[model samples]
Target chain A: MTRRIFGVRTLGLLGLGLLLVGSYFGLFVAPAERYMGQVQRIMYVHVPCAWIAMVCYTAAFVFAVIGLWNGKPRWDARTTGAIEVGAVLNALLLVQGSIWARATWGVWWDWDVRLTTSLVMLLLFAGVLALRSFVDDSDRRATWTAVATIVAFVDVPLVYFCVRWWRSLHQTQSTPETVSPAMVLPLRLNAIAILLIAIWLIAQRAKLERERLRKEQVDEPARVTAGLEVTDA
Target chain B: MSQERKRRRLLAVVALLIAGGVMAYLAFGGIGENLVYYWSPTELREAGPRAFGASVRLGGLVEPGSIDRQADGLTMRFAVTDGEASVPVVAETVPPAMFREGIGVVVEGTMLRDGHFQTQRLMVKHDNQYRAPEDFKPEDMKELMKSLQFEETGT
Candidate 1:
């Protein structure tokens, strides 16, 4: 318990540090674009959110595969937890991307492959959650979810390569050499920070789910006996 | 013991497969459109004068009086300046209507043999508020100063 508490506190401090550095570098250190003015600052939030959401989905898919192969209850729980978080982050990404697009592209949405694939990912997560709720047996849920997770992960590559494969206007990947030193440094730091925070959130939520399941297990027999007694009465 | 180890090994292999898929995508995915680059006029100039026909973006202030309206009046020619250097841009399309002298503009095209911009695209590069005439209103114009909210005066 103490170790768990320590882990959460450590992640919090680390996240705070990264946030401060990211904001400083992105806002103050980086030179403003010659054309876009300060609106370019939107890149700081938009890029990281998209990157982290992709990573989260990837992580969840890995765990889903592990759960399927090894039939491990822990991995199953982690898979579900990660997917839940990834879904929320993916939703935020869609919203933020739309906002940035409206500001930059003059339209709130587009039919581009990247946006479509991201929406597909969001729907995939929703589907997985729906499957989990309807399935009564834990093993069945894990098995089906593992299959669904693997299939949906194929969309990540589709999304990443969408611009290249199609004639979309979205720009290419963010590379260290392509960006100003000031901009790249903060972006790299924020990427790491966001990844860590995402992992921490998944871990925390998994732990809570584990504790809840354990409590339910402990109460199950008592509840069954109480029901039997009432029926007899 | 053997069965459990076999299962663990299977999971490990699956993880490796997923990793390999992501790596392959990173290496070769989206080859096109990834080349889209946004540069300031200052940086474009700093690149030390590309070959006359090299495609590049010349971003800067549209120099006053440099605008030459054609007889047709729909087409216009203007120069973008970064205070240090300037590039003349010839735009055939009707300017964004509100597009005028002294505002920020980004002209996308290649540098010509004569050092002018053979612009294929001309963008007004508006701030948060400046909507096009389709949604333009007097009230929206009033909010432009507040919405832009920049400290640097374009003087």
Candidate 2:
């Protein structure tokens, strides 16, 4: 357990170091945007958070599929951890998006397709996490969450394609043809840094979940024995 | 597994499928109805009375020399053009700082009966280029760094 903690800590520290370096380059080295000026620096963090959140959700979807197929507790633990981290990052994405919107769009929130669909995705995953907590039986919880995650994942593609399919206020996807090389460097670096952090967080969370499961298993026999004694008395 | 367990599993699977189908239908139906939240001037013209008084977003470039600030500084009028068609816009709020002539913009409002768009929200669509201002020189960066350092030192 200590060794696992040490590994996660080292990964977290590496992520932090990369984040600091990426922030320095993003803030001080990258040129200001022609229109948004310094406010555009937020994109370095915002885009990364959004991407990592989506990636985490996608990982959770895969874990859900695996858990359902194999009925493995480890896969279920991974799905839960990924969903928690993804939801946190999703909330951060919304907040950061709101800030950027206020600066660029002259409004904090809009009912545009892109924004609305992303919110729906976040809410759906949040519902899955809530449902997981409400159920007590581990196997039942795993089965239900796996099913919910699969259903919620339908929104992922919608969120990605919303800008293309509808008349959205939000800008379309950023690509090499759109962004400059200097800007891409910081964006890429920050994305890598955030991805590392997300991996470390998910790993630590999954480990904690496994430890809890172990404790529960250890107590199950004692609990049954206690119940038997009570019934006998 | 017992026969009862198998029956329950089958029922659960069937329920999930039905739920997924219903959700997909509702989601797609909503998207279809709201697909075109905004219309270009050409599309608006084609829609004609159908678009009148309905809340919609209009996106295009701001025509140069067409911006007119009303008696109140907050209210402004401008014409949005897509190079093929133009729509006059009257907005109640101040335009964003990036709002300017020839720049891309998306205005959300209702189309009045008199062929004008009444907007309460204005958004400036900036291009993807991240470059310093034309006037910004490399030497200015040195001074900027120095000032930043001085501020950090509270000197």
Which candidate ranks first by lDDT, i.e. highest?
Answer: 2
- Candidate 2 Cα outliers beyond 4 Å, as residue runs: A222-233, B1-34, B127-129, B134-155
Q: Write down the DockQ of candidate 2.
A: 0.21
Record all residue pairs in model 2 with backbone atoms less than 3 Å apart, i.e. clashing.
none
Q: In model 1, what are the clashing residue pairs, if there are any?
A: A172-B34
Candidate 1 wrong stretches, greater than 4 Å: A219-233, B1-155
Worst 10 residues of 2 chain A by lDDT: A224-233
Say which candidate scores most in DockQ: 2
DockQ of each: 0.05, 0.21
Model 2 agreement with the true structure over A4-108: per-residue lDDT tens digits? 668877888888899999999999998888778889899899999989999999999888877766566787888999998998989999999999888877889
Q: Write the per-residue lDDT of candidate 1 for residues B56-102, one digit (tens) a residue.
A: 65555667789898899767788877565677778766555436666
